[model samples]
Target: MQDTVRRILTARVYDVAEETPLDGLQRLSARLDRPVLLKREDLQPVFSFKIRGAYNRIAQLTEAELARGVICASAGNHAQGVALAAARRGTTATIVMPTTTPGIKVAAVKARGGNVVLHGDEFDQAAAHARRLEAETGAVFIHPFDDPDVIAGQGTVGLEILRQHPDPIEAVFVPIGGGGLAAGMAAIIRFLRPEAKIIGVEPVDAPTMKTALDKGEVVTLNEVGLFADGVAVRRAGDLTFALCRDLLDGIVLVDTDAICAAVKDVFDDVRAVAEPAGALALAGLKSWAADHPGSGTLIAVNSGANLNFDRLRHVAERAEIGEGAEALLAVTLKEDRDDYSRFLTLLDGRSVTEFNYRWSDVGTARFFVGVALKNGPAEKDALIARLIAAGYAVEDMSDNEAAKLHVRHMVGGRAQGLAHERVLRFAFPERPGAFLRFLASLKPAWTLTLFHYRNHGDDVGRVLAGISVRPEEQPALTEALGALGYPYVDETDNPAIRLFLDGARAGS
Candidate 1:
């Protein structure tokens, strides 16, 4: 390990980049009462810090060894780093990525002149395949963060942080996937700045390091969610696990929504988009600051910014509650139209962030409403009281994990008066007034049975709209909708939809 570290230190590829600015974040610093500094690794040449290790590790091979070329597995940022570094070193590089990896990442790898092979459905599978390819071709395996050389390369980041600040840093939050970055940073900090806290952050859905630490051994997760693909590692690397066990001060878990909120915050502050994993370190710091009150030097690594633009809306939808800026309520009315009117009136002063309603003949109609809150506990209490006064059963959806993830995607209400309904899949341009225009073209008295709209980042927006048609008015309704000249496909024949709706209704 020391030899690997020495190799890393001696590598000619090691370019001493200027230290990142540790400017105080006014909004976050004020919130946490701590001097929170953002390590702007997202501003790197590849818009990520992965290049440091990639270049360092590749530079170490002897002339004969370098002739063998190299192979590695990564979903995005790492692939770009290795590809670019290999190009600079005049060495052949091959990257294996999961088939599900985004096209943008694959394109970036190609743009950097790396031969990319799409393999497997997940990173682990792709990694395994990469190992087989390495064996077949006798290619040098550039283990992403596991090998000692890689860790040494990543440790440079810690060196830079310490040199730039030269202050009593209370904590440095580093994002963990396979524990490579965290392990490297932790080892350096533990060895040099013994008093500094090294907190490792992982997406809650993929807490490989935390799980390993809890088990007192490295344990591979059977399944991992890929929403935060940058950190959705199923298992920690062997060498990284060892370094992390010895060096890390603590491991912090941040949920997907919190990650989204942090990403949104970074984008707001610097107008730069960070992938979920990139923003995770900031999320951990914010979470830690909320619990521990202090004013000390804190650094959080902004790891990468290779996010798909299409996923922004989904992230935005969850950010409000994640940051405690909005409250989601599942409100059910006990009475008739009068009670509904009274409930709506109660929200006169509040700005409704999101409002979705579904009616049922079985009982009261349910409304999923999100309201913005200026203050935390006080606003929550007042809102609960208002719901109670208005005779509404309000179930807080703010912290309900199930509702935030699954239920929000699948569940909705039913309209009782619909004699006929037709489900249509429509693709319309996603612009400022697209939705309003669609509503304007619709005729009155035709009840909306179901509606789901999520942005896909393309000009075209996908929507599933269930239109209730009166038997006598069907012909005219279809004619009017057709005359509007929009592309539409009827999905009433889809077996999946039939089964889902039938099963849901039966269960209900």
Candidate 2:
């Protein structure tokens, strides 16, 4: 502990990293009913606290080690940190990144004079390749977490937090990837401020550290979601996992929508567009505040802000739902001109965020609708009850993952007599001709139906596709999908899809 403390105090990160401000989140404090502060690590040179550890690790290198060069595997922010740190030290970094890494991130590394090596489809594969290359080339491998010096380097953030706010703080939130920031900060905080809690945040889809803590050992995940690409690690670093397990008070697992909501909150309060992973801690903080409401001072570190401009559309679309400001519902009403008017009366002037209906000459009609809610869940529930009492069958689609992602933009449709129709969702790296290439890969025997895709400003392109085939073609179709080399989910049995894709009497 003394050695770790000494290393943190003497860490040579200031050469490339800045001591960012501890700023207040006004709107969030008012809403959460407590004083909320944000540790603005997003203000660093590389727009991430990663520069601290990256630069510190490089600083300790001997001239001979520097001459050998530095190599690392990162999906985004850490790559930029290492690139900038190497450039400042008069050397070039060779960054091995997953092919799925955002183009914006890949370009950032190149702009920093780092040689970019695009490798396998995910971070783990890229890291494996990097280690193999490191062993062969004899270049120094800069572990993103795991290393003691690197952990001490990141501990500087905790040093700054305590120095900046010496007053009482109920808890401090940190985002965990392979657990670099969380482990480093947790060690220092637990040592210095014994009463102040150190909590870690993780994406529910990629619970690297949380899973490790629960299992009492590190475990590799088969897959992780790419929504929060920065912290989407399949496995937690061995050292970091140990530190976080013993030091952190607890871990909070949040979903993508909650992350989107936190991004919106940061923007609303600080006028900053944090990348999904950057806002992760705040998302967890909100969950914590909700569960234990009080006037305690809470702080969450805004870890990074390397967001791609295109991804804002997705952030905006989900933010309302994430923050409970909007509701999505599937409603059935009698087919008539006055039906919508009657429905509007039931809403009592609440703003409608969306209304999608496919014109059909039938006795009843199904519509996908989005309504603005001022009272959040309570208002949403009340509205649903009113619609039901008025003879309008309603399905609240707010919490349905498929409904929010696809049905909102689904454009009402009733596919009739389509045999062996299968609805599937897929995601793949976005690049020139990527969509066309995927389209070309479809089997000649199966018919493509109900294809929906929109660019959500992510480096990954996602598509909701439906296919029709003969019963005999099922085996072949399944085999062909696996050959595509992209992860896919069978959405045919999803409740949201089943609701909208079921029998709709149209043109009767």
Pairs in clash, predicted candidate 1: none
At residue 302, give the lDDT of candidate 1.
91
Clash pairs of candidate 2? 310-457, 311-457
* Per-candidate local distance difference test: 0.77, 0.85
Question: What lDDT does candidate 1 reach at residue 118?
Answer: 96
Q: Could you tell me every candidate's TM-score relative to the true structure?
A: 0.80, 0.82
lDDT of 1: 0.77
| Error at 456, model 2, angstroms | 14
Q: Which residue window of length 10 is worst by lDDT in model 1?
A: 499-508
- Cα lDDT of model 2 by residue, 266-301, tens digit: 999999999999999999999988888788899999
TM-score of 2: 0.82
